[model samples]
Every structure is written in C-alpha cells, then in structure tokens.
Target: MSSSDIFIGEVIGTAVLILLGGGVCAAVTLKHSKARNAGWLAITFGWGFAVLTGAYLAGGVSGAHLNPAVTVGLAIEGGTEWGKVPLYLFSQLLGAMIGAVLVWITYYGQFQAHLTDREIVGGPGAQDTVKAVPNSEPGPVLGIFSTGPEIRNVAQNLATEIIATVVLVLAILTQGLNAEGNGLGVLGGLITALVVVGIGLSLGGPTGYAINPVRDLGPRIVHAVLPLPNKGGSDWSYAWIPVAGPLIGGAIAGGLYNIAFA
Candidate 1:
C-alpha cells in the first residue's frame, strides 16, 4: 500500500479500535450506561472485539498495525519499512486522539455525572472513587481511557508491560509467518484479537495490560487536554512505562523471532 493508504487505514482502524474499546470502558464505568458495573470480563471481551473489528476493517489496506508497538515490532522483524514507521505511529496516535474525543462526546452526560456525581448520594459506584479535590492530581477516571498499575511499583509495572507485550508481539509474529505473508491473515486477526483478550485476562491484572504504546498514550493525552468535568490528573509520571516497556518488549520479540523462529 502507498503512504496515504497506510496512513488512512491506520487512522480509521485505530479510531474504531479506541472508540469501541473506550466505549466499553465508559459503559462499565459510567453511571447511566446500561452496561454499568458489568465488570472486567466484559471489558476484556469488548477490547478483543474492538481489535477484531479494527483489524478486519483496516487489514486489507495497511495490514492493520494500529498499535505503534506492532508497527515497530514488524519493522524490526523486517516486515515493515523503516521509512513508513513514523507515518504509521503518527496516524495511530491521531486516530487514538480522535477516538478518545468521540468517546467523550458519546458519553458526555455519563462522564459529567460520573465526575460530579460524587456530591450526590451513592453516585456511580465503587469505581467512581475520585472526589476531585481542588488542584488535586488526576483521579481514577483515567482508567476508562488509559492503563494504570494496581500496585504502583515502577519496576513491577514496567516488567509486567514488557513481559505481556512480549507475549502479544510474539504471538503476532508467529501468526504472521503464515503462507500468505500478510501478518495474521483475516482469520489471524480474530486469533490475534483473542490473544489480546488472553493478555488482558491473564496478565492484565498487574498493569491493565497496555501492550500497545499508542493505545495508552493517545487516550492519555486526550484525558489531559479535554475539558472534562473534574477529570483528574493524566498520570504523566507513569506514562513512559507503557510506551517504553512495550517498545522494549516488541523489539525483544522481534529479536527473538529472528534468533529462534526465523
């Protein structure tokens, strides 16, 4: 595909990915949504479905490498050109931002209620923990848009991301080595989506399983900038772990693929 094709495909695919993914988060977290408090199984499956939908929609055009870590891993494995990596990353980030904004718009009322409902009696639920103190840091609502460590240990969180991302990228690399040469042919998308669901279920408990760099960063940036009511801090301090650990893990996966699988 040409540059424009790759860019547009990634943008649309990633936007859809985040839209559905964030939508699920909003559904489970927000007060008024019908799926409120649906729990983590719904989220894991929802995100898997999101990946399946996005990859299928964009797979024909740009291979549907919507995550920067995926793109980097592919490039390191000689599956993608170095020159195109920047475009892919930029498009993914842009798509993530756009998707996040759409989520905010879709759940505008819910977010408002979720944020301010703390004043009201039994507002939202136990997840609605942020009280929004004056000038206080970003609150717990961030989990809807981005990932955070449950234990808050930098080394442990980073290690979790790296290890989980290795599993993810390695799965992709293995699946992509099919006869078709396309990274995870149409059926592989579904399988990869399941792999993501697996990661979320098995390894996600520690750090929310943010194995994708753009997936976390884009929405986190939107969280920081958007004028949502009483939306707490963006948690910039821990942002680097998701990005760096995933990149490191992806690169290691590529290296491992080269040494062991290739």
Candidate 2:
C-alpha cells in the first residue's frame, strides 16, 4: 500500500478499534447505561469484535496494523518497512485519540451522571481533589480510557502488560500473517480477535491487558485534555509502563519469532 493508504487506513481502523473497544468500557462502567456492570466477559467480547471490525474495514487498504505494537513487531519481523513505522504510529495514536473522544461524546450524559453521583465521587467537589494522579488513585472513569493495575505495583503491572503483549504480537506474527505474508487476511482477523478475547479473559485481571501502546497512551492523553467535569486525573504516573512494556514485548516477540519460527 502507498503512504496515503497506510495513513488513512490506520487512522480509520484505529479510531474504530478504540471507539468500539472503549465504547464497551464506557457501556459497562459508566452509570445509566444499559450495559453497565456487564462485567469482564462483555468487555473482552466487545473488544474482540472491535478488532474484527477495524481490521476488516482497513485490511484492503492498509493491512490494518491498528496497534503500534503490531507495527513494530511486523517491522522487526521484516513484514513491514521500518521507513513506514513512524507514519503507522502517528496515525494509530491519532486515531485512538479520536476514538476516545468519540466515546466521551457517545456517552456524554452517562459520564456526567456517573461522575457527579455523590456516591461515585464521594462528595460534591471530590473531582477537584481527584485531579492529581500522584496524590491518590485514578479518577473513576480512567478505566474507560486506559488500563490500570489492580495492585499498583510497577514490576507486576509491567510484567503483565509485557507478557500479554508478547502473546498478542507473537500471535499476529504467526497466525495473522496470511499466505501473502502481509496483513491479517479475512480469517486471520477473526482468529486474532478471538486471541484478544482470550488474552482479556485469561490475563486482563492484572493490568487490563493493554497489549498495545497507543491503545493506552492516546486515550489517556484525551482523558487528560477533555473537558469533562469530575473527570479526575489521567494517571500519568503509571502511563510509561503501558508504552514501554508493549514495545519491549513486541521487540521480544519479533526476536523470538526469528529464533524459533523464522
């Protein structure tokens, strides 16, 4: 694909990925929504379908490497050109941010209702206090935008993200590669989606299984900047792990692929 196609496809694909993926989080987490409290299984299946939808929409145009982790892994594995990596990353991040904003818009009323609830915020003006990430736990809605650790330990959280991401990137490297050695062809997309669901079901408890760097960082940035009252802090303190751990995991998966499967 050409540069423009790659850029557009990635932007669209990633936006849809985050929109649907984050949409589920919002549906299940935010108050007043029908899907609220739908639980982890709902989120995993929602995200899986999100992947399938995005991959299908962009597969023809850009091969739909919607995640930077996938892009990096493919580059290291020699399936994608290093020269295109920056474009892919930028587009994906941009798309993810757009998607996150869309989620906020789609559930604007729900967000307002949830955050302003005295019980949810603990009091009338608690959002002001929750704005500082270093001072205390994250805002109530942070999980809608990005992942966080249940235990808040750096080592364990980082390890969970890295391991989950390795499984993700490695699966794409091996199973998502079609006969042409390019994108996740039709069936591959479905299988990859299922793999994501599997990752979420089996490994999401630790750190929400962020496996993709931009998937976490982009939305977190939006979470910080968006004008939502009582939205609380973006949790910047734990941000780097999702970014670094996924990249490390992608690189490790690529190297491991070369060692054993290349």
Candidate 3:
C-alpha cells in the first residue's frame, strides 16, 4: 500500500478504535448515561469489540497496527519496516485525539452533568480509609479519558504496564505463524481482539491496562487541553509510565519473538 493509504487507514481505524473504546468508558463512568456503572465486564468487551472493528477495517491497508507499541513490536519482529514507523505513530496519535474529541462531543451532556455534580462524582467517602495524596486543585473527570493506577506506586505501576503490554504485543506477534509462515491471516483481528479483552479483564485493574502509549497519551492530552468543567489534572506526572512501559514491553516482545518464535 502507498504511504497515503497507510496514513488514512491508521487514522480512520484508530479513530474508530478510540471512539468506541473511550465511548464505552464514558458510558460506564459518566452520570445520566444508560450504561452508567455497567462495570468492568462491559468495558473489557467494549474495548475488544473496538479492536476487532478497527483492525478489520484497517488491516488491509496498514496491517491495523493501531497501537504504537504494536507497531514498534512488529517493526522489531521484522514484520514492519523501520522507515514507516514514524508515520504510523503520528497517525495513531492524531486519530486517538480525534476520537477522544468525538467521545466528548457524543457525551457532552453526560460529561457536563457529571463534572458539575461533585457529590455524585466524588462523594463524602470516595477515598475510603486509605491516606490519599493531597491535590489542592483536583480535576474530576480525567479518568474517563485516560487510565490511572488504583494504587499510586510508580515502580509497581510501571511494572504492571510492562507486563501487560508484553502479553499484548507478544500475542499480536504470534498471531499466525505456521510452517507456511501464514502470519495472523484473517483470524488475526478477531483473535487479537480477544487477547485485548483478556488483558483488560486480568491486568487492567492495576494500571488500567494501557498497553498502548498513544491510546492513553492522546486522550490524556485532550483532557488537559479541552475546557471541561472540573476535568482534573491530566496527571502528567504519572503519564510517562504508560508511554515508557508499553514501549519497553513492545521492544522486549520484539526481542523475545526474534529469539524464540522467529
């Protein structure tokens, strides 16, 4: 495929990925939505479906490497060319940002209602008995857009991201290797989608299973820049964990694949 094809495919595919994925988070978290408080099962399946749809739509053109970590892993695994890496990353990030904006637009009323109502959002006993770090000026709704660790231990959080992402990228890399070197084939999208759901169900509790740098960072950037009422800090301080861990995990998966599976 041409460079334009790759760019357009990734942008559109990733935008849909984030729209449905982030949209599900909004559905579950935001107030006054029908799916509000629908719980973790909904989110895991929602994200899996998001991956399925996006990959099926974009795989032909760009191999549907929606996540930068996946792209890097593929490149390291020799499935993707190094020259094309930058284009993929840029397109994915841009698409993620666009998708997040769409989510806000779709759930504008819910966000406004949720952010404005403090009692409903962070009630009297929101923190529980645990001693929470003091945030003098907290933003309320950033969680809808990005992931945050339930427990804020930097090393643990980073390790969680790395471990989860390794599983993700490794599953992706091993999609369809056969004596024929068939390589993922049509079943790749569906299988990888299920893998994503599994990761979310099992590993998401720790660091929200970001596994994808652009998926977390792009939306976080949107949350920081957009003028949402009481949309708390972007948590830039914890941002690097998601980005760095997934990247490191992807690279590790690449090396492992070359060593054991290639």
Candidate 4:
C-alpha cells in the first residue's frame, strides 16, 4: 500500500477501535443507564473486540499496531522495520487522538444530559456544583484514565499495568511466533480477545489495567476536553504508570519471547 493509504487506514482503523471501545464505556458508565458499574468483564471484552476488528481492518496496511507499546515492542522483536517505526508510531498516536475525539463528539450529548441531570438532582450545594465548571469536562468513567490500585497506591497500580501489558504482549508475540511464517488468521485474533478477557477477569480489579497508552491517553484526552457534569483534567499523577508499565511489559515480553524461542 502507498504511504497515504497506510496513514488513512491507520486513522480509520484507530477511530473505529476507539469509537466502539470507548463508546461501550460511555454506554455503561454515564448516569441513568442500564450498564452502570457493569464491571470490568464487559470493558475487557469490548476492547478486545474493538482491537480485533481494528487489527483485521488495518493489519494488511499498517499492521494495526494501534497501541504505541505494541508498535515499539514489534520493532524490538525484529518483526517490524526500524525506519518505519517512527511513522507508524506517530500515525498510531494521531489516529488514537482522532478516534478519541470522535468518541467524545458521539457521546457529548448524552454526557451533557447526564451531567445536567446530576447537577439538578444533587442541588446547588453539591461539591461538584460548587466547583467552577470548565469549558470542557471529563468522561463518566474517570477512573479509567489514571491507575488506582486496589490498595490506592502508585506502586500497585504500576505493577498491575506492567503485568497486564506483559500478558498482552506475550500473547501477541506467541501468536506471531506460532504462525511459523504464516499469519494468525481470525483464530489468532480471537485468542487475543481471550487474553484481554483473562486480564480483565484476573487483574482488572486493580489499576483498571490500562495495558495500552493509546487506550488510556487517547480517552483521557477526551475526558479532559469534553463537557460533562463534574469533569477533571487528565489525572497526571497516575498517568505515567499506564504508559511506563505497558512499555516495560512489552519489552519484557519481547525479550522473553526471544530467549524462549531462540
């Protein structure tokens, strides 16, 4: 495919991923909804399916490494061209940002309505009401942005993200290796979905298992700019963990895969 084609596919695929993936979160979290606090299982599956579809769509063109961690990891593993890495990573991040923006637009009306209802129900004395309403607002599930451990500490959250990303990257590497010059077809994608489900079921209670910078940062940006009831800016305090953990995990997975297979 041409360079322009690759860029287009990256943007469209990432937009679809975030639209469906983050859209599910909005459906579940926003007030006056049926899926409120439906638990991490739903989210995990939602993201998994999102990634699967996105990958299938863009794999041929851009390889669908929508997450920077994945792109970096693949490069380190010698599966990706080094020269193309910068372009791909940039495209992925840009695509993710665009996708996140689209998600915000799609859900803005619902979020506004929910926030207005909350403000009315809570009365003027509510803490959120007392705070100055910003030009933009955060999303309903704000916790997803920053890592908060079950123990409510940074170390734990970092650990959780690292472990989750490790599992995710490992799954990807394993699938690639097992392909034996062949490609992972649909079954491989399903395996990835299952891996996400496992992580959500097992490790999601803590840190919310960011596992991907694009997954967290893109949506977090939306949360920061989109109007809502009582939204806050990007939770910078805990933001580093999601990015750091995923990168470390991907690196570890790549190294381990190399050792085990070589």
List TM-scores for all candidates, in order: 0.92, 0.94, 0.91, 0.85
Badly placed stretches (over 4 Å) of model 2 are 124-136, 176-181
1 against 3, candidate with superior TM-score: 1
Candidate with the larger lDDT of 1 and 2: 2
Give a tens-digit lDDT track for model 3, residues 127-222: 342112233333566777788888999999999999999999999888753332223558888999999999999999988888999899999999
lDDT of each: 0.86, 0.89, 0.84, 0.68
Model 2 scores worst on lDDT over the 10 consecutive residues at 127-136
lDDT winner, 1 or 4? 1
For each of the candidates, give the backbone clash count: 3, 0, 3, 1
Query: Which regions of candidate 4 deviate over 4 angstroms?
Result: 119-140, 144-148, 177-184
Best by lDDT: 2
RMSD values for the candidates in order, in angstroms, are 3.4, 2.2, 4.7, 3.5
Looking at model 2, the pairs that clash are: none
Model 3: which ten-residue window has the lowest total lDDT?
A: 129-138
Pairing residues by index, what is the TM-score of model 1? 0.92
Ranking by TM-score: 2, 1, 3, 4
Candidate 3, lDDT over the whole model: 0.84
Writing each residue's lDDT as its tens digit, candidate 1 over 65-115 gives 888878878888888888888999999999998988899999999887777
Task: Return the candidate ranking by lDDT, descending.
Answer: 2, 1, 3, 4
